[model samples]
Structures are given as structure tokens and as C-alpha cells.
Target: MLVMHTPPQHHIVILGAGFGGLRTALELEKRRARLKDFHVTLIDKRSEHVYTPLLYEVSTGALHDNQKFCVGELCSGVAVPLEAYPQAMRSKRLTFKRGEVTGIDPKKKEVHLKDGTRISYDDLVVALGSAVSTFGIPGVNEHALFMKCLADAFRVRQRLAEFLGAYVEGKEKRVEIVVGGAGPTGTETAAELGNFFDRLVKNGIIKRKDYEIRLVEAAPDILGIYPEKFRVHARARLETIGVILMTNTKILEVKKKQVVTDKGEINADVMIWSGGIRPLDVVKTFGLALDEKGWIPVEPSVLVKGQKDIWAIGDVAAFLDPKTGKRVPALAQATTKEASVVAENVTRRLERKRPMAFHPPSHWVTAIPLGGAYGLVDFGSWSLRGRLGYFVRKAADFFYFFSILPFGQAFRMWLKGTNVYIKND
Candidate 1:
């Protein structure tokens, strides 16, 4: 006699709970009525889904609840619980399991969890997101601060607080904050730190020259991908606020109190590494071939190449643009859109309908918060700057919150974020 094992058996098992994964889970459940008896299981190690766009604020201490902030309210308010999904609560079809994926056996269609439990699936959606890439720079993994997740945000906040406090109390001669990387993360963190330092000056805590920030980038120019207009505006504003632009300066190594660069060594009371992101190691366990960048190659419809029922999306997927033949940048908009495409494709496949090809936007909007009160929003056709641009950026945050949360909860979360982060401006 043969016996079938129980899954909490699911037909579709989505991995990771980031924007791509969480949205995929909820959207699939919305169409649960079509799947008949088949169920969807979404698994992740963490309980909360981090909204990364606001993590810069967290690092700058804007998300602090009070003197005790330390990314408390923002972590909870910005990152909603996985169990908070209304669909998962109401439907038996959608299930959220909190577990870390250890390995995957593609031949058996099974996912092995950290706790030694195995889950078999007919179709698998891999949305495991990216991690900060040290790029093998010496001492970066040991001495530099990262801004990838909530825990990183908290570490940055606490470490900055300790260093800044030391400077304020006259225990340190001066503060030197070096942001390594000229990308959005590095630029934003440096610009926001300028505002925080200015506030300290206004409050008589530190002199104007007591603390300095240097933004180092190996690239020739900052915001290299943004249009000339946005880049010019951001560079100008950052300089006006005393953030030293060190473009074309390559970071060679990180020391305890200094950064060794191709140009010269610079003192670093705090070093923030916003260099880049890479796919997690878990992707390798799936027994799938990855592109040169360690991201899986997928069809235009996002089905993994050479894999029968495995689909890849978000940072883990090397989704290409038909026009440019370049992989889509791991922007938030593209990630969320990938969620919709994957959700629809999977549901349609289950319904015996053909999957649709994904056509992402030709130009992705770029939002750079220049400082506490100022921002630059580049819409490709036109752009906004100053207070208006900042408001637009904040509006995007609210829009994202509303998209994922119920109205009341979203409103409360938005209110909290706005209240805490407004002072950042």
C-alpha cells in the first residue's frame, strides 16, 4: 500500500516575505476561489516584512520613538507582522509559516527548513531577496555598518548614537562619518546625517565644523544612473550642507577608525557601507544555475529557465528588458510589479490559461531625499525638487503603506512614521 504525506500540503509554495513574496502571497489568496482545493504556503525566517525605503530614516534616528527610539516604532510600524495579513487570517487556502529555508531538492520538489521539516510542492516561487555585498573589501564585513534590514538599522542607530554622544560630551576630539558608496543609500545616509549634525549645532551641542561627512564612490559621478538634472541638484545640495563629495575615490579597505582608499586614508568615526546588494546564499541551495551576477535567469514571464515549475522574481531574478537587453534594476516598483506578474501567471497557469509576458517600465522614477527638508524626484519626463519633492517622496511611502495594510492600520503606521521622521526634515 502507498501512502501520501501531508504538507500542510500546498500546491504553490512562495519563498521569502519581502515585498515580492508577501504581495505574491496576498494576491494569490485573493484569487484563491479559482484554485479549488489547492493551497498556497508562504515561508520566511522573520516575522515582519521590512519596508526598506524608510530604513535610511531609521539609520539617521528618525524612526526613534523618543530618546529610546533605536528603531523601535519604525521596526514594528514600518514592518508589519507576517501574521497580520487579513487574507491569511480569513482563508484556509493561504498559510504563512515562519521558518528559515535551509536547502532545496529540486529533483524531489522539496524545501528543507532549518528545523529539519521538509515541504513538497508542485510549483515554487523563489523571491528570496538581496543582501548587502561587501565586494570582498578588507574589514568591511567586520568594521562597517550596513543598512540592509531592521537589525542593521538598529545597529547603525545605536553605534551612531554612541559615537555622536561621545562627541557631544566632549569625550571625542571630533566625529568623522564616512559613507562608502555613491548610490542612493550612501547619498541619502550622508545627506540625512548632515541635517542631524545641523540640528546638533542649532541646539548648541556641536560646532558647525565638529563633525564632517564624506561620501566616497568609485564611480566618476554621484547618482550615476539618475538624469543630469537630479544628479546636479543632489550634488549641489549635499555640498551646500557640508557633505564632501569624494567621487572616483575607490574604497580599498576599512579599518577600526579609518577607511583606506585609493586616493588616501580618511578618519572614520563611523563607516557606513552602502556599496551594493547580492542574492542570499539560500539561492544556491535550490540547485539552479544563476547568471554571472548570481541571480537566476528567468523567462520574460519569469519562469526560471530549464526548471519546469520554478518561478523567480525580485532581486533573485535576473529579469531582462526586451528593449535594452539589460536586467531591470532592483527598484521597489519593479519588485512589486514582479509580484503582480508572478501572482497572475501562477494563477492563470492553475486555471489552464497562458501566462503573460512582463513589460516593466522603461524609466523608473528616482527619489533622493537631499536632506531633512529637501528632496529630488526624477520622473524621467519632469522632476521636482526642494520641499515639494520631499512631500512627494513621503507621499510615496504612504501609498506603499496603504497598498499593503488595511486603512486604519496603514493610517496609524503612516502617522507614526511621519511624526517621527518629520523632525528629520
Candidate 2:
């Protein structure tokens, strides 16, 4: 008589709890009933997952409607705790580990943590996101502030508040803010800061002529990736709010109290960099096939080139979109969709089934808030401006938090009733 033995369980480890990693975990949870002997462990340096879209809002102190919320308050609730997944804990198949990843040994299929612990895996998913890239610019690393994480937003707010206090107390004559990049991050931040300063002037906290905000861009036009109409609208909106545009200007170096540009020099009290991002250093340690730009190159199926058991997603993965014939932009929509493909592929591979290729939308729809009650929306050729766009942006934000947060918490956050907002008398 022949006896049958169950094969050893496949241990799957995912690094980073950003959109890609979190969505992958949710997808795998649904397969708990079918995929026996399947284990998934998610690892993130920080236990909380940040909602990155609202980052600029926090920086500008416009994260609330009727009330005010501190930067820390906004970020504290926006970040969902990775370990708060009751469903995952109940299934006994998914677990969350908090630790910074030091390196990856592909030969041994192991991940080394900074805390001196090692995790072995049969399959690995790399979603560790990118960080601000200074492009070897002198003084950029030492002087400029970044807007990449929750902590960054808080720091910016703190500095702005300090500057405002100094100006109101007659210590400083003027406040000059210089923003670099002119992409969505830069545009949104500039708009928010302008609006915040306008409010200060209205409330008599500061004089109108006390602050000067400049947005510097290396490109000829701002929001260059968007349609021409949207770009025009964005420029007009920003100009109306008194944000000076320095197009086709490149920053040579950031100094202690000023930024030197190729065009000239501008004295500034604050310099925020939204310039660009590059893949994290740990990505190279995975021994994966990287593109010329040093980003992990993956197929439409989200599989690392030439490797079956290893996959890459999120900002770290460089995938050429077949429909558009361009590299997919690192957006929340792209990351979430890629995560689904990766999860499905992993399930199919484990069940001895063929994997499916990822098919992204040919065009993406996006809304850019222009501070206060104004925003702009772009859906291919069509566009919407003003309050309508603002509501749409709010609804989109609502759906995102709703999908990720508990029902009650999502409701409060969406309705302006969240404790995140502080009521000022």
C-alpha cells in the first residue's frame, strides 16, 4: 500500500506595507480556504501604513473642513496599523512583522532584518517603495526638506509655524518659500501654502506683503505630464493665488537661507523639495534584474525578469504599459492594480495554474486639489474645474480610506467629525 504525504507549506514573505503590499495581503486572505499550507508574512519598518495622497494637505494645514487638525493628528489616524487585521489573525495564515529590512540573500531565499533576525521564504514579494532622489545636487541633502513621509509633513508645518510667529512678532521682515519640482506634489503644496497664507492675512495674523512664495521648475511648463488645458488651468489658478512661477529654472544648490538657481539666486526661509524619487537601496540587494535606471524590471505579470518565485510591485517595479507603450507611472491606482495581479499570479502558481497578465487602463483619471474649495480633474480629453472637482477629489479620498479603514472610522474621517480635526474656539 502506498501512503500519501502532504507537501511542505510555502512561506510567502512580502516587504513594505504600502499600497502594493497591503493590497496583496488582502487578496491572499481571500484564498485562505482554498490554498492550504500557504503562509504569508508582511514586513514593514513602520507598523502604520500612510495615506500618501493627503500628505500635502497636512503640510499646508488644510486637512480639515470646519476644524483644524495638527500634522501629527492627521497622520496618526490616516496610517492604518498593519497588525489590526482581524481577518488575517483569525485565518492563522497571515501575520505582520515590524522591522527594517537590511538585505536579501537570493541564493538562500532569506531576508535579513536590522534587528538581527532572519526570515526564510519560498516566495518573495518586493514592494519596498522609493525615497527622494537628490540627483547629486550639492546642499540638497543637507538643506532642503522632503515631502515623502508623514514625518516630513509635520516638520514642514512646524517650520512654517515658527516662521509665521517670528514675522508676527516683528523678528522677521519677510518669509520667502521656495518649492522645487512643479510636479503634482510641488503644485499641490504651493497651492496649499498660498491658501494658508491668505487665511493668515485675512485673520490679521500676518501682513499680505510679508510672504513671497516661488515655485521653481526645470521644465518649460508646470504639470508637464498632464494635458495642455489642465496645465494652463493649474498655472492660472496658482497665479491667481499669488504663487510666482519660475519655469525653466533649475536649482544649482540649496543654501542655509537661500537657493541658488541656474537663472539666479533667491533668498528663502524654507526650501521644500518634491523633485523626484529613486528606488530604495535595498532593492539592489535582492539580486533582481534592474533596468538602466536601477529600478527593478518586471513583466506584465509582476514577476521579476527571469525569476519565477520572486515578484516586484509598487514604485520599485518598472513595468512598461502595453496599452500606452510607456512606463507606468508610480501612482496609487497603478500600485493597487499591480498588487492584485501579483496576488493572483502567486495563487495560480501555487495551485499549478497558469498566471494572468496585468492589463492596466489605457488612460488614468486624476483630480488635483488647488487648495480651498477649488480643484481640477482630468479624464483624458475631458476636464472639470472648481468646486465640482473638489467634491470629486473628496469622494475619491473617501473611497480610499473606506476600503482600508473600519467602517465607523472611515465614516468619521470622511464627515469632518474625526477626532483628527481639532476644534478651535
Candidate 3:
């Protein structure tokens, strides 16, 4: 009789547990029964996965009923613990590892962690995401606050609270929060400050005139990527909230208390940068082709251009959308869809099946909350505005949490967030 031998189970490792990575994990977990030949390990520096859409909401403080959540409370609500994914926790093949990656040796198919541990993988997924881009602007790195993670949001709130207290004590005449971007995050953040400051005014904590939210943009219009109608509504809502719009104002430098712009210099008590993001430096060492922005260029199948078993997704992957003939935007909705492709492709390759192309929907539902009970949701061919739009926005948020979390937990989260957001008007 001929001697028989079994092949060792293949290992799949995913770096970063952001939207794409987490979604990919869930996708793989669902296919765990069929993926008996493989096992997946998700690695991240932080154990908790942040639900990023509500980030601006956390920054703006209590938007409804004049309530306020401390740094811990806000963070707890937005950041879901890795253990929350009960299905993934039950998957025998799926495992979570908490470690900061120090190096990647693609030739060896190994990932080096900071704690002197080395993990070898048969397949790798790089979804490490991106960080704020300062564009070599002087003082930006040293002076400006970023809004990338939970800690960053906490710091912003702390600084704003300190500024408010100083103003009330007559130590400062005015407190200016300069937001250096007009994208969805910056726009929503600036807009929502209306209700937060209004609550302060109502409580006699600070007068309306004591604080100013200055939203600066280098572009000619705010929400530059959205349709004109959406921009019009957003602009109208922002004006109603008393947010100062400084369009076509290029920030030459960011200082401790001032933002020097081509349009003029503005007095800033605090500068928050939501300007842009660039890929992490670790990708350069991955032996992958990086675009001009340092993002890894991936094929239509979402595989890293040069490697067979390596894939990249989310903010780190420069995936061109065939439908638009442009690179896909780094949105949570888009990332989840991309995760589906990566998961499916991995299994397909293993089974000697054909891989599918990366085709995302033309209209990923985007809801921009423009303060209070107002929001704008774009659904490709049509859009919704006002109360209905706000409802849809919250609903979209609901579905997202529901998709990743247990039904009961998902409902509780949605209820809590909706209750606070609905009463904002």
C-alpha cells in the first residue's frame, strides 16, 4: 500500500481591524465550514474596532436633549470591542491577535510583531488603513489636532472644554475652533457644533458669541464631491448653524493660535485637521506597487498587483472602480463590499475556482448629518433631505451595526444613537 500524507492547513493573516479587515473577517467566518483547509488570524494594535461614521458626532458632544457624554462614554459607544462579533468568536478557524506590526517580509511570507513574535502566513490581507496627511505643511504636524482615532477625539473634546472654561472665567475673550477641511467629516463636525454650543448657551455655561466654528476649505465649494443640490442644502444648514465658511482659503501654515491662509489670517484657539489621509509607511516595505499617494495598487480582483496570495483593501488599496473609471473612495460601505471580494477570491483561489472582479455599487448610500434633526442622504439617482433624510441616515447606521454585531446588541446601539440624534432638532 502506498503511504498517504495530509497537507498542513493554510494560514491567512489580516493586518488592521478597520472596516475592511473586520468585514473580511466576518465574511471568512461565514464561510468557515467550507474553509476547513484554511484558518484566519486578524491582527491589530488596538483590540476595539471603531465605528467611524459617528466620529464627528462624538466630537460635537451631546446633540440631543442637551446631554453630554464624557470621553470614556463616547468612546465606548463608537468603538466596538473585538469580542462583540459572537459569530466570529465561535468560529474555530478565526482568531484575533492584538499586536502592532513592525515589519512584513513578503518573500518569507512572514509578519513581524513588536513583541518579538513572528507569524507566517500562506495568504495575507493588508487593510492597515491610512492616517491624516499634512502635505508637508509647516506646523501642521506639530500644532494641528487629528481626528483619526478615539484618542484623537478625546483630546479634541478636552481642549475644547478647557477653552470653554477659560472663556467663562474671563481668561479668554473668544474661543475659535478652526476645522481645516470641508469634506464630510469636517463639514458635519462644524455643523453639529451648533447644537453643542446651543446647549451651553441654554445652560448659561457659555454665550453663543463666545465660541466660533470656522470651517476652512481650499476648494471653491464645500462638499465638493457631492451634487450641487446636496451642497446647497448643506451650505444652507451650515449657515443656519452659524458656521463660518472660508472657501478658496488655502492654509499656508497652522500655528498655535492662528491659521495663516492665502485669503487671510484667522485667529484659532484650536485647529482640527480632517484634511486628507495617506497610506501607512509599512506598505512601502511590502514589495508592492504604491501609487503616488503611497497607497498599494491592486488589480480588479483586489489582489496586490505583483503578488499572487497578497491582497489589499480599504484606505490602503488604490482600487480603480470599473464603473466610474476612477479609484474607489475609501468609505466604510465601499470597504465592506471590497471585503466580500477578497474573502470570496481567497476561497476561490484555494478551490481552483475562478476569482470574481471587484465591482462595487455606483451609489453607496452616503448620509451627511448637517446638525440637529437635519441630514442629507445620497442614493445615486435620487436623494433625500430634511427629517426624512435624517431618518434614512440613522437607519443606514442601524443596518451597518446590525450587519457586524448580534441582533440584540445592534438594536440597543441603534436605539441609543438614534434617541440622542433624533432630539437634536
TM-score for every candidate vs. truth? 0.94, 0.93, 0.93
Rank by lDDT, descending? 1, 2, 3
Task: Give me the candidate number with maximum lDDT.
Answer: 1
* Ranking, TM-score, top scorer first: 1, 3, 2
Which is superior by TM-score, 1 or 2?
Answer: 1
Winning candidate number (TM-score): 1
Please give the RMSD to the true structure for each candidate, in Å.
2.5, 4.1, 3.8
Q: In model 1, which regions exceed 4 Å deviation?
A: 1-10, 62-71, 86-89
Predictions in order: lDDT: 0.83, 0.81, 0.81
Per-residue CA lDDT of model 1 for 167-253, tens digit only, reads: 757788688999999899889888988877777777676788778899999999998888887888999899888899999999999
lDDT of 2 by residue, 126-148 (tens): 99989898888899888888889
